[model samples]
Target: MKIVIQRCSRASVTVEGQVTGEIGTGLMVLVGVTQEDTEKDAKFLADKVAGLRIFEDEDGKMNRSVLEIGGKVLSISQFTLYGDARKGRRPSFIAAARPEQAIGLYEAFNEAVKAHGLEVQTGVFGADMQVELVNSGPVTILLDSRE
Candidate 1:
């Protein structure tokens, strides 16, 4: 499991010119699942993301978690995080999980995030989506279950 977490003041996803999921003041999470990913990996990431202290506190120090700031989450399925292009002009997606297996884990990850008592929005799985966001501080974090 791998995730790219971007802190944002607002974010939204659109499919076929229709808005699917939208949020104000939150994290835009791009998630990727590999063949080895399981519910345990999902759970670990959910906990880590929810408690991550990326938001700034009153003193301008990054000391607050999203929950503390009453922020939301916009989760998107992004298998391309596993793309490998080191050896060729074209990238290989062999590390990405098959759609059937990935969908389940993706849903599980969202559920795990919701278990933290924070609002969670999502993009349509397997759909072509256009995501927009105002990145707050441009703060971004990368997480990998294997690490």
Candidate 2:
């Protein structure tokens, strides 16, 4: 499991001109589930994302976790995070999990987040969606479950 986490002031996902999910100050998680990912991987990644201390604190220091700041989450399933581009101009997506498996893990991940007591929003799985976000502080982090 790999996740690209971006702090955002606000974000929204729209499918077929209808808004699906949106959030206020929180993390925009581009979640990717690989063939090797398990339910434990999803749970572990959810805990990691929930406790990450990237948000600023009283002294203006990045010492507060998203949970402390009363933030929400916008999680989008993104298989392209596993795209292997070392070969040629064309990137190979063979490393990505099959849609059937990926969708299950994606839904599980969101459930895990809600289980952590935070509001969670999500994009439609396997849909052509438009995501809009106001990236806050440009504060971003990359996380991998294997790491």
Tens-place lDDT digits, model 1, residues 14-100: 999999899999899999999999999999999998999999999999999999999999999999999999997999999999999
Best by TM-score: 1
Which pairs, if any, clash in model 1? none
TM-score per model over all chains? 0.99, 0.98
Write candidate 2's Cα lDDT for 75-132 as tens digits.
9988999999999899999988999999999999999988989999999998998999
Q: Candidate 2 — which pairs collide?
A: none
> Each model's C-alpha lDDT?
0.97, 0.93
Q: Ten consecutive residues with minimal summed lDDT in candidate 2?
A: 107-116
